[model samples]
Target chain A: MYKIESKEVSLYYGDHLALKNISLQMKANTVTALIGPSGCGKSTYLRLLNRMNDLIENVKIEGTVLIDNKDIYARGIKIDDLRKKVGMVFQKPNPFPKTIFENVAYGLRVNGISNKSYIEERVIRSLQNSALWEEVKDKLNKSAFELSGGQQQRLCIARALAIEPSIILMDEPASALDPISTAKIEELIYELKDKYTIVIVTHNMQQAARVSDRTAFFYIGELIEYNDTKEIFTNPQNQRTQNYITGRFG
Target chain B: MKKIFSRLLNHLITVLLYISGSITSLIVILIVFFLFSEGIGLFGKKPTEDGFIMAVNKSNTVNHLNAEQIKLLFDGEITNWSEFGGKNDSIILFRMDNITDYFTEEQIGENFENLPACISKVVDSIPGIVAFVGKHYIDKNFAGKELQVDKITVGDFMFGKLWFPTAHPVAVFGALPLLLGTFWVSIFAILFALPLGLATAIYIAEVAHPTVRNILKPVIELLAGIPSVVYGFFGLVVVVPFIQNAFNLPVGETAFAGSIILGIMALPTIITISEDAIRTTPRSMKEASLALGANHWQTIFRVILPYSSSGITAGAILGIGRAIGETMAVLMVTGNAAVIPHTLLAPVRTIPATIAAELGEASQGGLHYQSLFILGCVLFIITMIVNLAVEFISRRNRRVAS
Candidate 1:
């Protein structure tokens, strides 16, 4: 059974259609990568999984987005609960202007967790999972801004992980990072799929091939192809996907 | 020809911008120098050896005097007249009345203008004695002997306890309470304005839709441009009555009332600066919070408010400086009483208001006159401190942002 599914979903920004009749399924505990050029509705489609599009004004979404067989857009669905289940990391690292410990513990604190032992344990576990604990454990009380860019990105990932979401959404999460930082994030993504269903939107084809289990190609707001990452990279399926991957055209 | 025209235009623009920037600094320096030099004159020592102490009245008449035969008449000494050659007359002392012109007809009397007539009247009314009065009140209609006028030595004036420096014993202008009152009122005004103003800024910057923000932002900004006198009038008419009625007081003029009005006046500055700061918080921060399952209130409080805290603090200090420096509005609403504030509801006098109310009629070189200048200097120092604090906070905020 699929962990998350989107059926015939379309989205609009006022009168302009942004996504047209998208459909896909993501399996549990696997990494799925969405690759597309800018403004191809790839990010827009990923945002719908957690109802993040609700924050934008005049954004009209159609059809249903389901997670764990529950319609996330249904009337009784709480945005906060949906977001908790599906955590998101942005392209740029945005650690809170707080201590390293507080940055990772922010979500827990916001959820009204008062037990210090529980928060401390969860923060350590999350940091260890994101592979940033060793480098920053000594400076947990230092401001998050004190960390370098690469460490800040990892800290953001640790912050998201501390919430214990079943699914992690990465919206071009490594795009703004340097080569070394990007490699570290890709490695972290590969490790993350063991415990969380991951959906990443990336323009880097090599990164998608390296880290993702399944790959979906989007063009002009339409889903061009979705298949196993190996198959998509090796076999002839869609001309547009081939062209985008082969560097002929975007 | 074209090259020359453009060059000429460039030079003209540069000159205009430079003049605009330098005008305020130059004027401020001149004003400070003027106040300092003139204020320092109150402490100038006189060379004259002969001296006699004289008492004056509100009528501007000189009626009694200490004979020049005496070595000296120090301040707080000679409370009675028998010591000064008068027949056991209690020396009636008159204050400067916080009026700017010590020699003004309203301050002295509508009828009397010189010391001699005042002395004649004093002698006729109080029997035989000597008194020092305003120079404007001097004439030969009085019967009492005119004592020699004692020049106010600089040393005596500075250390003098009382502020009666008119024509005889130069009054010492006490600045301790007036300065304290100013600080208290301004501090209270900032305390009142900071939170309310920042909340309004957050609502406009982060929460309001375009339409609501457009409508409310200008209205708040317009408050900063309103003439302070108009605010004073509003405080006088509306706020004073409201406070008086609500508090069951005899009058409405009070420190609390002044703080409220000044707070309202300062709202535009605080809101504008803080809103700009909140607006400039990186959008990525907002996205980060939202992605963490944090609710709108949580994100606003945790991220937006903390990020903009320094700017909000800057706005608050600027607002406080404005409140402390305000003159007309405070004078109208604060009851202009130069006493230390015991409660928010009590009437209070701020430094700027005290200076404004008293500088108009105070003697040009008298202690009362120079003390007002000193008050101006105090205000200048306070505003400079506030600006410096703002700079420090801004630099720290910039470092954090980077």
Candidate 2:
């Protein structure tokens, strides 16, 4: 059964349309990667699931998005509830200007769960899951800024995890990190899929191929191909997918 | 030839630019130099008017009187000479203008030609008499003992409790009351402006739609451009009555009213800078917050405010700079009272207001005029310190944001 689905989704940013009608589905506890060049609507499509596009000015979204088979765009849908179930990691290691413990506990605090032990347990678990636990365990009260670049990115991931969302969205999460940090994040994504459905947008085809179980190639606001990661990278059926994956053209 | 012409034009432009910049700096330096030099001159000089002396009856053992004691003695606030450790006698004050009361006009003679003898007789007979007379009035054989009060000192000028710069015989030039009044008004102005301005900034940066923000931001900024006198006028006409009615105070032109006006004046600075700062919260951070199920307000309170804390601090200090240096608005509404303000509801006078109200009436090169300049010096130092604080906060703001 599909954990998340978009039926004929189209998005417009004022006069210009950013995403064309695109249908995609992802199974529960699986990693899906969106590979595209700049301005290719991959990020736009990823933003649609959590309704992140609503924050932009003059954004007009059409069609239905389903998470856990519930239409999120329907009337009476609470954004807070929808967002709580959908976590996102950004391109930059954008941790809150807070301590590591507070940054992880931020989700619990915002969601109004104030039991101290529960928060501590959840924060420690999230940090451990993001593979940043041992490195920062002794200094959880220190500022998140004191961490190295790779550790900060993992801390952000840990922050998202503390929300306990079933679906996590990664928008070029490893784009700003060093090679070793990229490897660690790719490794973390592989581990995250056993408990959370994951969707990621990336410019790097190899990273996408390594981390994602399913791959969707998008170009100029249209989904060109959607298939198993191996098939998309090794046996792409579309011309543009072939060109993008093999570096013929972006 | 064209290259040579362009080079010559470039040289001319450089020279012109250099000259204009130097001219501007030179003018500012000259003004500042004049203010400090003249202001500092108030010290080491007697607070009394030049060529003026006070005379006590030869029998009266009052050796010297300072500005405050003389003012009190003349004003009838002090009824007996014993207040200054003199003999327990009711004080009898005499002035040049009171010659008729001391003696009949005919007895002093037609064009006051016998005024000298009459004054001498009055001073000699009135044992408790303290006469404030010019040197021209005293003859060679005057019976009264002339006394010179101690010169004003910087310590007295800064820490003295009285602020009677125009008091006769000698003027008290205590700066304490004016300093406290400025401090009191500015602190309250900040208390009024900071939170309100920060809320408006948050609305503009975080909550308002683009069209609303565009309109609201400029309009709030335009509040700063409105002349401070207009704010003073508004304070006097509207805010004063409103406060007076609300608090049931006897008068409305008070420190409270001055603070309200100054806070209004400061709003534009705080709002504009704070909004700019609030707007600088990285989009990535905001997205991250929202993605974690944080509401808009939560995102704002938890992420944006903390992220831009330093910048908001800079804005607040700059707003304080505006409130501290503001003159006309505070002047028109603060009742111009030169007493130490003990409460916000009371009438008070800030430094700039004191200078503006008194500068016109103060005679040039006198103690009053120079004290006003020193007030300017104090104001300059305060604003300079505020600006420096802003610089420091802004630097920290940048470092944190990155």
Candidate 3:
């Protein structure tokens, strides 16, 4: 069974249609990378799975987003439950102006986990899993802002991981980082897929090829191609995908 | 040629900017200097009216008396000189009007030329006489000795409880009542405004629909523009009566009424600034909190409120600045009684109210006028401290953001 599925989903921001009927399926423990140039609706599509698009006013959505065969957009859905199951990391390293420990512990605490030792263990495990444990362990009480850009991004990842979400969605997470940090995040994403089903939106085609098991190429508002990363990179599924991957045109 | 012209224009603008800046600073300095210079003159003048001298017999041991002591003695409150550490004697009050009792007008010349000698004789005969007379009335042949009345000291002016600047025999200029009044009213105003303002700001900035926010934003801003006198009027008719009825007080124009008026007056500042601060919290921060599965209220409490804490503090301080300096409404609503405030229910007077109430009646450049200037200086210093605190808080907030 697919871990996550979207069935003919379309979204409109007021009168302007932002995403067309896009359907995709992902298996458990697989990394799916959504690749496109700017304004390709890739990030918008990523946000739809976790219902983050609901934050915008006058946003109307159609069709169904299914996790474990349950439609999230249906009536009587507690959005908190949907969000807790699907964690999201953004393009920039957005950390709360709190201590490093608190940043990681935020999700657990907000979700009503009040056991101090349990929170501490989860924070440590999340930090260790995100590969930021040793560098930040000594300064857990320090502010998250004191971390460098790369470390801050990892801190955000640790924050997302601490919630123990079954699915993690990253929107251009490394676009704001340096090349070294980008490599580190790519490696972290590869490690993360062993536990959480991961979907990442990236502007870099090489990044998509290197980290993703399968790739979906979106153009304008449509998914131009959806295939295994290796096949999508090497084979010509569509002329537009060819152009974007080769830097022929955006 | 164009480059040279542009350079010349730049230089002209630079000179203009420099001149404007210097003029503003100079004006501020001169105003402050003017206030202090005039205010400091109050120290030079004695608390007694000009040419009024308190005299005693040459054999009397009392050589000095303060204004309060002299007032008590003349009011017949102090019956004996021993209370003031002088030789034990019953106090006798003497005024210039009592001269006829000592001698017939015909014994003095028709022109009253021999009145000085008679005054001398009266003072000489009465050893315990404490006489209030004009300084010019004492001549070289006068037998009475003048008791020294000390000039008003800064300590007396600051800590003195009485504030009767226009008292006929001697005007007292104690500022403690006015200071505490301003202090109590401001504290109560902020205490009322901060929580109320912050809650309204949160609703407007974070929770309200755009339509509701649009309607509320300008209305609250308009609340700020409404003059204090109008608010004072509202308090006078509505709030004062309500308070009077509710508390069963004798008068409505108590400090509580003043506080209500000031709190109402200070609300717009607190709300508008707090809303702006709450709105300035990065959208991404809210997103981060929401994405963590925290509800909207949680996001507001945990993320938005904490993020805007310093800005809210700056707003509260600025609101206090407004409350402390407010005159008209406070004057109208607070029963204008110059007494140290012990309770919020008591009628109190603030420094600004005292100045506004007395400036016209106080003859300019006189002791009373200069005393008003000193009040202005105190108000100025309080306002300056509040503004500096706001500046320091905002600067630190900016540093943290950067």
Best-fitting candidate, measured by DockQ?
A: 2
Q: What is candidate 1's lDDT per residue for B196-237, written digit by digit as tens?
A: 998899899878999999999888878888999999999999
Model 2 Cα displacement at B192 (Å)? 2.4
Clashing residue pairs found in predicted model 2: none
Report model 2's TM-score to 2 decimal places: 0.89
User: Which runs of model 2 end up more than 4 angstroms from their true locations?
Assistant: B51-66, B73-148, B244-250
Off by over 4 Å in 1: B15-25, B43-170
What range of 10 consecutive residues in model 1 chain B has the weakest lDDT sum? B63-72
Q: B275-351, model 2: which lDDT tens digit per residue?
A: 88888888988988899999999999999998888889999999899899888889899998999999999999999
> Tens digits of per-residue lDDT for model 3 on B1-402?
999999999999999999999999999999999889989889857888888877898988888877667666777889998998988999998888888888998987899888778888999999888888887778998888889876788888888877878875777788999999999989998899889999999999878999999999999999999988899999999999999999999998999999988998899999999999999999889888888899898888888888998999999999999999999999999999999999999999999999999899989788899999999998999999999999999998998788
Q: Please, what are the lDDT tens digits per residue for candidate 2 over residues A1-250?
A: 6999999999999989888999999999999999988999999999998999998878998888899899999999999999999998988898888999999999999999999999999999999999999999999999998999899999999999998999999999999999999999999999998999999999998899899999999999999999999999889899888988889887
lDDT of 1 by residue, A2-118 (tens): 999999999999999999999999999999999988899999999999888888899998988889999998998888888988999988889989999999999999888989999
User: Which parts of model 3 are misplaced by more than 4 Å?
Assistant: B1-26, B56-130, B137-146
